[model samples]
Target: MAWIILLIVGFVGGTVGSIAGLGGGIVIVPSLLFLETSLGVISNMGPQIIVGTSYLVLIATGLSSTIAYMKQKKVDFNSGFIFFIGSGPGAIVGALINRFFETDQFAGVFGLLMIGISLLMFFTKSIKPIGIIKTGKLHTYTDENGMSWEYKYSTILAIIICFFIGILSGLFGIGGGSLLVPIMLLLFGFPTAVAIPTSMFIVFLSGITGSVTHVSLGNVHWLYALALIPGAWFGARFGAYLNRKLNEKVVVTIFRLILIIIGFRMVINAIIG
Candidate 1:
């Protein structure tokens, strides 16, 4: 039953994640925490284990989505790679910091972070690209359908934001796409179409780094993670397909609601426990 639940959760997570460019970790982590609490699966260690497992699931989901996005030529490899450079080291630092928190403490922090992310997602409005800085080398990308986009941003700002996102990713076992996508859209003025795939690519890199760190810390449960793999892979493909079809505003609205609900639940649980 537990295995079955994990599989189902993984599929749902992957699907919504890919479509919203939020990554599976946002869904997987909270769902796993709720499941464990309800089922009495692991007692005191449940939250930590759930976080670890979410990262593992994220690795698979991120890779699958990134591939799909790549095939569509929707990903900006240059910008994504630049973000990845900062994320890698930041993930390691976050993992190291995670070692100091107790399970409840971790849950509290994760929940609060989720709430903050939800608020950011909810309040942000779409804006046209403006005040383009012409100093840096312009990065241009052409999608599979011959659509082109060009943009430039401060390298230092990109690094700072990506590094912070990576820390949250590693600490909470999120893939960082939830935060990254929004940052790209709001801060860097990236188009929705461009931000989703580019964020997925960055998430893939950070997921790998965070997953490795969690594995080294003995936080990941291999059996649970293994159960999630197949479902996440197929679901991610389906979600990426839907990304082309669905309305971005609708997707983001749903994403924000889910985050708020889960975030509140986790925070309450932490306080009560």
Candidate 2:
């Protein structure tokens, strides 16, 4: 029954993730916790296991999705590499921090954090690009590959943002897509399609780094994570198709609502527990 529930969660999380450009951590963690709680299956350690397992499953989804997007010319490899160059170190730091918390405490804090981020994503309106300079206009440039580049801010600013996002990813075992995608689109002015693939690319390494860290601490549930990947992959493909068919605003609205609900549930559970 738990395996069956995981498959359902995987489908829901993957579909929503594909559409929203998040790796689905926002939904995955809460859903697992809720399921574990309802079943009364060692609730104390369930949250940590959920985090570890989600990242493990994400490794599969991220690799598959990244390859698919790269083949379609959706990913900007140079840009992704640059962003992740700084993020790699940050992830390690975040993982170290994660290891310090007790299971129940981590779960509560993690749940509340998800809820806050979700609310922010839902309510926040337009956040304009940060300029290359404090006073400069947002500029778009074409690269040698004919890919469009918008460096609203300086390279330094971009690096800073990536570093912070990476830290968050490591700490929470999230893919950082939920946070990175919006910032990339709204702040860097990257196109939605580009942002989606880039988010996947970024999440790949972050997920691996976090997963490795969790594994070292004996927090991962390998079999459980493996069980959900097939369903997640299929759901991702379907969700990607749906993403192309929907309007951007409508997609975002629905995605935000899903985030809010998941976030709220996590917060509520945290409080109760």
Candidate 3:
């Protein structure tokens, strides 16, 4: 019965995360805690273990979504790789240092981060991307309306920003899309279609690096990962399908609302705990 619940959690997490490019840890981590602490469906769990388990689940979610998006030609492989170069190391560092912080202390900060992201997305309009170096690449996407959206970014700047995001990903199991997607959208002026799929590609790569650290630290619960994998894999594919059907503006609106709700929830949970 607990396994069944967890499978459902995975499905929901993957679906939402894939749609939003938020990496589903937002759902997976919280649900696992609810199961363990509230319902007693699982036992002997700690926050670290839950985080580790979440990253393990990300492997499946990221890989599945990356494949699906790639097939649709939605993924930006060059940009993804560039971002991963920085994020990879950052994730490892975050995992190694995660043990030092009082996990609850971060709840308020995380909450604020989410809230701020929502506000930024809500208030901002499309703008030209900054290029710290002339070597940055230009990416373009054509929407169903036959409108082609073009964006560019600096590789040096992106790498720097992504490294920090990777640390956050490692620390929070967030897959960094919550932060990366917005930057891609606003700072880099990437289209909704391009930003989300490319974000998933980065999530997949960083998940590998982050999971390695978690595994070495014995933070993962393999059984839980096993339960989450099938649901997450299939759900991600489904989410990718859904994404293709939605309007770009609609997707951004959904992203904003979700952030606000999640931010409020995180703040409340922190206060209660």
Candidate 4:
């Protein structure tokens, strides 16, 4: 029965995450806590274990979505490469440090981070594409392999953003796709299509790094993670397709509303705890 609830959570999370460009942690963790309490699978280690196991699930789901995006040429490898260069190493370091903390503390920290991200979503207004792409002074370049590229300040910002994202990924067992996609779209000026693919690429690296860390720290629950994979994979693909059909403004509005709810929940939980 608890497992069934996890599947439902994964299904819903995959769909919401696909539309919002998140890795699904914000949805998954809260759902797990609620399910665990309802189902009486009480364990002091539940939160940390859930987080660790979720990253393993993220790898499978994220990998499939990445392939979907790559085949469509929606991935921006140039930015991905730069972000990877920074995040990969940072995640390794963060994962190693995670072994020192207890689950309750980790949950508190995760909630705080979510609250910050949610507030940022509420306050941030317009996203401009002008400077992030080639204008009169900027020009697109083509590599020998025939792939086209545009250089922008957003690429530099991506590297900086990944540094912090790496720490969050390691600490929370998340792929960091939640933070990566929005930053890619808003800060880097990537289109929705391009941001989705690039965010997936970032998730691929970050999830693997965090998963390895959790495994080494003996925090992972392999069986549980495996159980959630099938639902998340199929749901992710379906969600990705739906995202393409929505209007940008409508999508942004809905996304912000979800963040607000999640954020408020986190803050309230923090205060109560």
Q: Candidate 4: which stretches are off by over 4 Å?
A: 37-44, 123-151, 154-157
Model 1 C-alpha lDDT per residue in residues 87-144, reported as the tens digit of each score:
8788777877877787678777888888998888875654554544446667676765
lDDT string for model 2 (1-273, tens) is 767777877877777777777877766776766666666642444555677777776776667677777666677777777778767777767767766765556667776776666665664345554433543235554533677765444566777888888777777767788788867766677766778877887777777877887788777777677667776776666666676678867877776676666666656666776
Between the candidate structures 2 and 4, which one is better when assessed by lDDT? 2
Q: How much is 101 displaced in model 1, in angstroms?
A: 1.9
What would the per-residue lDDT of candidate 3 be over residues 1-273, giving only the tens digit for each residue?
A: 867888888998888788878777877876776687567998765677877888888988998999998898888899899989989899998888776655455665667767886787675544445533444667788876789987888888999999999998898777888788878876777877888898988888999999999999998988888888889999898889888777756876876787788788777877898
Q: State residue 88's C-alpha deviation in candidate 2, in Å.
A: 2.1
lDDT of each: 0.80, 0.70, 0.81, 0.67
Pairing residues by index, what is the TM-score of model 1? 0.92
Error of 2 at 249 (Å): 2.1
Q: Model 2, stretches more than 4 Å misplaced?
A: 41-45, 123-125, 130-153
TM-score of each: 0.92, 0.85, 0.89, 0.82
Single out the weakest 10-residue window by summed lDDT for candidate 2.
128-137
Q: Which residue runs does candidate 1 get wrong by more than 4 Å?
A: 41-45, 126-134, 141-148
Instruction: Report the Cα lDDT for candidate 1.
Output: 0.80
The whole-model C-alpha lDDT of candidate 2 against the native structure comes to: 0.70
> Cα deviation in Å at residue 149, candidate 3?
2.2
Give the winner by TM-score: 2 or 3: 3
